[model samples]
Target chain A: MSKFKKKTATSQEIPTSALPDIIFMLLFFFMVTTVLRETEIKVEQTLPKATQLRKLEKKSLVSHLYIGKPKQPEVYGTEPKIQANDVFINPDDVVLWVNQEKDKLFEDERDQITISLKVDVETKMGIISDVQQELREANARKILYASIKSVDRE
Target chain B: MARSKRGEAGVNSAPMADIAFLLLIFFLVTTTIATNKGLMLQLPPKPDPNQPPPDINKNKRNIFTVLVNSQDRLLVEEQPLNDVTELRSMVKDFVLNFGKPDADSRALYNSLPNSMKSQVLRDPNSSDHPGEAVVSFKTDRGTSYEMYTAVLDELQGAYYEIYGDRVGISADEFRDLDRKNPEDLAKYEEAREGIPMAISIAEPSKVGGE
Candidate 1:
């Protein structure tokens, strides 16, 4: 009777110890297989409000251009003599950067290019128009303007 | 070391193994994995009953249809354009020479008798003189957004030059000015209302040429 009892107790303990190992294996599998979503740049733009906005079905290639305050110029003296920069400048530099990196992002097809402009509401129309003009010169079509809907306050 | 026959009599091992086998098979069949690819575009669908349809078919001769496929080639009507700059010239010529509206229609239609005015009311592909020129942009699926936007910019620039507002007036300013002066309002109405340069966008039938 003692021997039989000892055998039963050992069998129960074996499965209990194996439970932790099984759990660890499952966790590892999930960690390795899971695909993380791509990171998107954050831009401040007040989108035109539309009640009938629909989600896009087909996937088009998009390059993002963020138009906001220009970077502060480097100061040389105690009293920083401000050098004037073009206030209404196009995001041509960004476009050039995107074009340089296009090979990695876009496949062999040329027509698949899409450029989305994310411009702040305060941004002048000239900036947007200039950027659009540059894009035209680049022979890039499939343009979209990105805007966020304003939330209604109570 | 000898087998314990007395305790083994009640053991039923076959059913437990069968259950484990069934569980494995269930998981194997149910599990699915997918890979994410490409950009997403929400296309405008056919307008609802309340929405007015913009006439897409104006004069066939003046109407320059540019189709940008998912591959980024520019097709004029069905033929590919050799150079991109040609688009601007084509649009310029069409707008400049848009013929006068018919005398009967001018009298019967709204007060504005300008070609630009008539063009706004006419379909893009309409064969009539003074009919508005239509520029149709049909993009294929999986096409990049950057390319499409560039085309739009080019078209807008061409229109802006012809309309005499290199920096086009804002919508708000135009609306405010619309109510103040009758003469200015008429000109604005004629420019804005008549077959203004129309842009229509369409998607290809299939994705990625498949």
Candidate 2:
């Protein structure tokens, strides 16, 4: 009975030598799968809703342009603005940005690249048209208007 | 003999879990799964201001016009339409009009294949045919993006429904058809045989506040 009791006591304590290995495996999984946010969003954009929303297939073939009011309304006021990458840019500068972005991609992939316009629904069409004009000037014909799926469509 | 004594102790692995935990926390804080997706639309070529506008002398009956004002009100063929959901059914009806044989065009309802013949109705006032049908969308400058996209969705939905019906499949299934597959590509082609996507977005009018 004493021997069996001793055996039970020894088996009760669990082995933790493989704990770090398991944690490391999970760490690697998250490290590979997670895509870190590239830019700090300054503009407050609430995307419009639609039923015909399509998912963007490739990430590398797309660039995002944010248009809306600034998050910090006190400093930037309530007027809508345009945000490209890390800086706030004027509408005319969109062409230059597109050219620069196109140059970053390979020659074959440049034509396939799509520009995603993330705009607030309440924003006026004046700035949107200006951006579209600039995009045309830059020869970026494919435009994706970022929108969420409407909840009631289901 | 003294050098052999240094092998008595092994490197400690107790801190490995702490290091891994720290990394996991960092990644959890810094990483964000990308949820960005949207409605894709191709823009037309830049307009030449010096050039004169092209003449549109076609039958007004063939052109299904939709006007969205600043107040987000929709006007279909000069009639005020309140509900956005009703827009798709209206567009579908106009596109698949199956009109009578006029002096210039044949009867569109009788020209369909054996498959699509039963699904469509013959209406002399609807349209000459799907091929001749055109959807013209005009939005005011003050129209919200939400209203614009909702209207656009209904327009596309109308075409999708017609295409799905012709192909004998659900509209969602038709929309999700894999173009990369040869069979799906053939179905898509057959579905869009006479009906082309003829949505024309006109230049915004200055009716609302800029």
Candidate 3:
């Protein structure tokens, strides 16, 4: 008779103590993998596209120089400007800036450090040549032109 | 009764998941996983003002000149080519002429496997061989970076495709050959021995824009 009697179902609650632990683990994973934005880009940029693009293998070994017209035309004017690190710089100052950046690296790693030219498509070659000349003067020979993979339309 | 009261006073962690979800959503919204990639080009050493440039006796037939004007027009070997996509196969044909055998041609293509040798198309007007072939790239000051890179891509793509075909591999695989691996390193070195990238970028013309 007792066995035949209906047994009340026990409400089983899921243990959520480990939920915070899992979340914390994910948080740490994200925090460790996130690359902080290197610099605030004041210039407008639309990277050119290409087929023979190679991924820059090491983030630590590359420094970018942004060249484009300023985003805020009212403030910075329509003329293309060069932004090295976090500051606006003249093309003449590239040598000094390259030297400064090179000095930050170890001697063995210095040669491997690439100076990536992030130039807008519309930017003229004059400034680009000036930057290239400055880079040559500074003995930073490796240059990577930033580009994306072109779709059929482009 | 006191124990019951203590159990009732336990910390509420119901909002913990919500908080974590908010943070997770924030990171998911703000962060990008893909890395930026590009074309790696090595600039020639700075020229010395005191030193005169060496004269090369390269025949006009051997030099494939590509000019990008301010209007983004592509001129290949002095002939205006309207479509950029045509540049790849055109360059490949120019670089791999199998019509007549020369000393340079023999030296360049002799090492390829027999299976690959049969694939070279015979063209008398194109380059004598890969070694003798030179692709000269130049651009006007007003030429957009897009056009410049597009031309460069086609040029390099030509070499990569040739190398890949000779080695019986894809271009991406050829590029991914790890130097750290002995077999891969050997294959890469062998592939590079024949179709060396010989694009010479001339100083951009100042005729376009100031």
Candidate 4:
């Protein structure tokens, strides 16, 4: 009985000695990774992984086009959706939206505008192709297919 | 009571950890990990409605066509390909082919080291030079986005591999080269002088697709 009590009772006190250090470390990690999202993402997105990826530069010149299924499938239905500015964007309005986005930028910088396509991996190409066609009509020629960087060959 | 009655009592430190915890929780809740990186592509300009399309003739040997159907099955250059990974080396081989070398390509070929020179298989039935090689990537409307991106990644990886080999650097290092740095820019320019990464995304066909 004495041996067991001595062995198990060495540190009954929950060690608060390193608690502050752990908390500070976590705080620093969060601080470094913190990118306050400008708008809430309404659709579910799981970015495809790729070994060959280039960093998208100049955020001001980049326009985002999100394609994925709605978060609440029961309410929004199962059809894949396109989103921009945290709102559901209709396929028909893509061209108009792109043109409007282009207009928001300076005329000289407009030529360098790149549309980033953040698409869900499981999404069908039909809607994406339609959007591409619409983007062509809008004259937004440059596009970036957003992918998560991975070291694995897969 | 005696310790508390001491004139110089140490300040309490019990609440310090709580303050840190609060700050940590705030940061964790307020932000997210944002990633903005991808494979960049240029779409073909909108075609003129009235005028006839330009009739530019390209040799059959120079075009490397890759097709992805609704089922995500690949058909590469008239042959059905099962695996996507095989496309990298195949594309690299096609781009490096010096079948009917012109004066400019001949000069470029001569500049290559003997080791690399031996590797360039002179397939007469294939592309004459890197400049002439055009990869036309086509997909069916029902193809999944995952397969599309995977194919694009392989095609782009092939170009990067060629560029890296030309400049005697690994592809990853070449990618990391600073565009703003004059020295790095010069090296990149030399690597890509004759070979432009020319990948054309053809309009997706509606046949056998949703």
Instruction: Using lDDT, give the best candidate's number.
Output: 4
Please rank every candidate by TM-score, starting with the best: 3, 4, 2, 1
Q: Estimate the TM-score for candidate 1.
A: 0.35
Which 10 consecutive positions of candidate 3 chain B have the poorest summed lDDT?
A: B27-36
Q: Across residues B66-97, which tens digit of lDDT does each residue of candidate 3 receive?
A: 99888889888888999988988888887876
- The regions of model 1 sitting more than 4 angstroms off are A1-154, B1-46, B49-59, B99-101, B104-127, B165-187, B207-210
State how far residue B78 of model 1 sits from its true place (Å): 3.2
Which candidate would rank higher by lDDT, 1 or 2? 2
Fraction of reference contacts reproduced per prediction? 0.00, 0.68, 0.61, 0.82
Docking quality category of candidate 4 according to DockQ thresholds = medium
Minimum summed lDDT over a 10-residue window in model 4 chain B is located at B110-119
**Tens-place lDDT digits, model 1, residues A51-108:** 1122222234555555543333242222111111222223555445446535545466
Per-candidate Cα lDDT values, in order, are: 0.47, 0.81, 0.81, 0.88
Q: Which ten residues in a row have the lowest lDDT in candidate 2 chain A?
A: A4-13
Candidate 1 vs candidate 4, TM-score winner: 4
Candidate 2 root-mean-square deviation in Å: 3.9
Residues A17-106, candidate 4: write the lDDT tens digits: 688888889999999989877877778799998878887668888999889999889988888899998789898899888888989999
Q: Write the per-residue lDDT of candidate 1 for residues B1-210, one digit (tens) a residue.
A: 356754665755445545554554554454433212112232333345587877755446656677776566788767787665577656655554424556643543444334434344343343233244566766664344445554654565455444433124532233234334787666565554444656655534354541
Chain A TM-score, each candidate: 0.49, 0.79, 0.79, 0.77
Better candidate by TM-score, 2 or 4:
4
Query: Where in model 4 is the C-alpha error above 4 Å?
Result: A1-29, B1-11
lDDT of 3 by residue, A1-154 (tens): 8989876796578888789778877877777777778689889788888878777767777889999999999998998999988889998999899888888898899977799989888887667877887888888988899987777732
Per-residue lDDT over B20-39 for candidate 2, one digit per residue giving the tens place of the 0 to 100 score: 99998888787766756677
